[model samples]
Target chain A: MDENNLIKMELTVNGEAVSMIVKGGRRLLDFLRDDLHLTGTKEGCGEGECGSCTVHLDGQSVLACLTPMERAIGCSVLTIEGVGSPTNLHPVQAALLDEGGVQCGMCTPGMVMSALDLLERNPDPTIEEIIEGISGNLCRCTGYKKIIYGIQQAAQELQAASPAGTVKESVE
Target chain B: MLYRKYEVAQTLPEALSLLSSHNGAVVRPVAGGTDLILQLHERILSADVLVDISRVPELRGIRLENGQLVIGAATTYTEISRSDLVLKNAFVLAEASKKIGAVQIQNMATLGGNIGNASPAADAIPGLYALQADVVVCGPNAERRIPITEFHQGYRKIDLNPGELIKEIRFAIPAEGTGTAFYKYALRKSQAISVVDAAVCVQLSDGVIKHATVALGAVAPTIIRSPAAESVLIGEPPSEDLFDRAAEAACQDARPIDDIRGSAAFRKYLVGVCTSHAVRSACERAA
Candidate 1:
């Protein structure tokens, strides 16, 4: 492996366009955490089995650990850090906190990302739909009961905020 | 590092050239890279050059041509599950694709990667087998087509040559009076590997089974079709007794072995149960 073989990629992360020289084998999870220091996207399994590395790649939820950095080239990436802020929390984030969905906190970021994507697609998802939407995410401590409630609460909150059923843009 | 260099191919020809240029290096064509990335991390597979085909527009789309459903190899499971053409013409494939992993995995995992990986427990293979799909491959010199049934030579072994890539998978639209169904018996409702899965496609005419195809997975070295069971249904009238016999024949066709997923006996039992369920569902759909 020569340094010259490193692939150059340009991507938009958290609404900021940037360029980097990444190794061919670098996983997106590693790139987000190491290069951008977006450590909010936790790595639970380092495999696609656990959804802890979930992120929005061009507005679709994908597992970062399984995604090669090259795939992110010329694409928009939305990680947990970009989803919402501490003071102006996204509805999903606020609902998770209100519902006590953060037990271990290891899977919260990914869960939030998944739930947000779910709400964006199905504004008024039923309980079953919410469970199915976030089925990929694994939470060991909350036993999924609080997580489901969090998504339910977020759906209602978002619907109330925007009667037209549009997710408020969380990007700052 | 599992791979030293990454090259993106904008076209099929560009990808083939890259493969030939790195002829001696361990070059692997990656689409979605859902399985390839994990394999690289686990040291299960190593490559010097990884040719990224995810961006190749030529290798992505779902369309109907001359009544045949043609799907590009790079088409993701999410795309397949959401495609109306697939849902109407090949509903079993859509059902199988929907059950593969979860939303993230469905978004990232490609049908070609699923076939290329050749996991016995892969959900799409059995459905493709039942649909009688054809795999189209291209290399530097020429292109070729292979039947999906003959595509797998053994466990994890495919009929693909070095530098050759699967371009598309095409199958005939099931004719009128035909019904198909796919079933997988996994441990969990989502993101679980199949312990035993079955896909059944049958055509009924004048209350008699005119045609039948039953494919089973996770119980053999490769996705296996139960010709014996299919033979039993060819001329028989649809009945609980007939389905029972076909299910028995399907169980006999399965060569399951004890593994972490299940015991051999348990898998064999599932073959019978799933086969029966699939056949009944297909029959109901057909009626």
Candidate 2:
């Protein structure tokens, strides 16, 4: 790699402050997968169209594949791994498993990120809203009906958990 | 990586200076990177250097300047659709932005990019043409404004000079009792490129249209204004017969070609249907 092609950037990823020397052309998806070994953020098309590399950048959902390292400077990135774990899954993640929203599991991570972002913006999204919310994330399996049910379940869980009727913050 | 070097500029002058300094190099300014990044990855477009202007504070806002609604070139579609000023002043533009793609693409795509890409089927360009938007271009030497009609030269071509960045897009707030509407026909409800798009702006006084503009996209090499239709609507009362006649005139003015999306004949037929519907919608809103 040419030294001139490298640049230093600071960003918070998954609640960790990361400052490193990365190629300016390196995509956020690659940086997370290759350098950090955070393979939960899957790459499907490697293009912006697939939405398989979706992640939350500063609380907004963006395609990690199209987001270059230079754009991530001073920003906060949240990947699928950051949202939940095996033992204690986030409401959306847990609901997906219970509702059978996962099949091949390739599009699961991206779907979770997009769903969390949607619920954060609109806590109680209708079936149509949920359909549009996850329209970017293509699921070849489950036919999306289960995924819609999963998001609705998660919304109910979040509403019940929060006595004040406000949904919980996605980041925990 | 496709690009050899990259630099993120903090300001408009810095971005222009960076582009100017890279003399003879194929340097492209990237804002939102929704299209550019994909083009570079697919080898459809090449660049020796990429200057990121997405973060330039001067190129990322929406505000009313004097009587015009000024939108920074880097302002994303999500912002444009959500801006109160844009919603109130240029509702057609907001509607167009919302239909560009799904939520993720909207968050990253910008109005400047839609113009810079110069796609014949760009959802936003039709609305811009109907609204009579102006393009603000700043280069190393000077800044100039180009009307949207003249801004596009040909297929995927723009009139922008080297080292010149699109700074902002401005369109006057329509007069009272005026209504504008946009309609797009695509392969899918979301994440689909437009097969045919139409936008209409109509101003009414005394129950008759005094001013009208109809712009159609994807049916020609560039988004085109239907002066034939506009002339038909002027001085005519809001009526289905008048709108149908105007739509027929707009269809006569369209020059579409056969593409995978649609046949030229089908697009020509759609031109009339879309125009009539858009005109009816605009007239209802005006009333």
Best by TM-score: 1
List model 1's recovered fraction of native interface contacts, to 2 decimals: 0.85
Per-model TM against the reference: 0.96, 0.95
Clashes of each: 0, 0
What CAPRI class is candidate 2? medium
Q: After superposition, how far is residue B64 of candidate 2 from its true place, in Å?
A: 1.1
**Structural similarity of chain A in candidate 1, as TM-score:** 0.91
DockQ (C-alpha based) per candidate is 0.68, 0.59
lDDT of 1 by residue, B188-278 (tens): 9788999999999999998888989999999999999999899989998889999899999999999999999899999999999999999
Candidate 1 stretches greater than 4 Å from native: A1-5, A22-24, A165-172
Q: List interface RMSDs for the candidates, in order.
A: 1.7, 2.1
Clashing pairs in 1: none
DockQ of 1: 0.68
Model 2 lDDT tens row, A72-104: 878999999899889999999999999999999
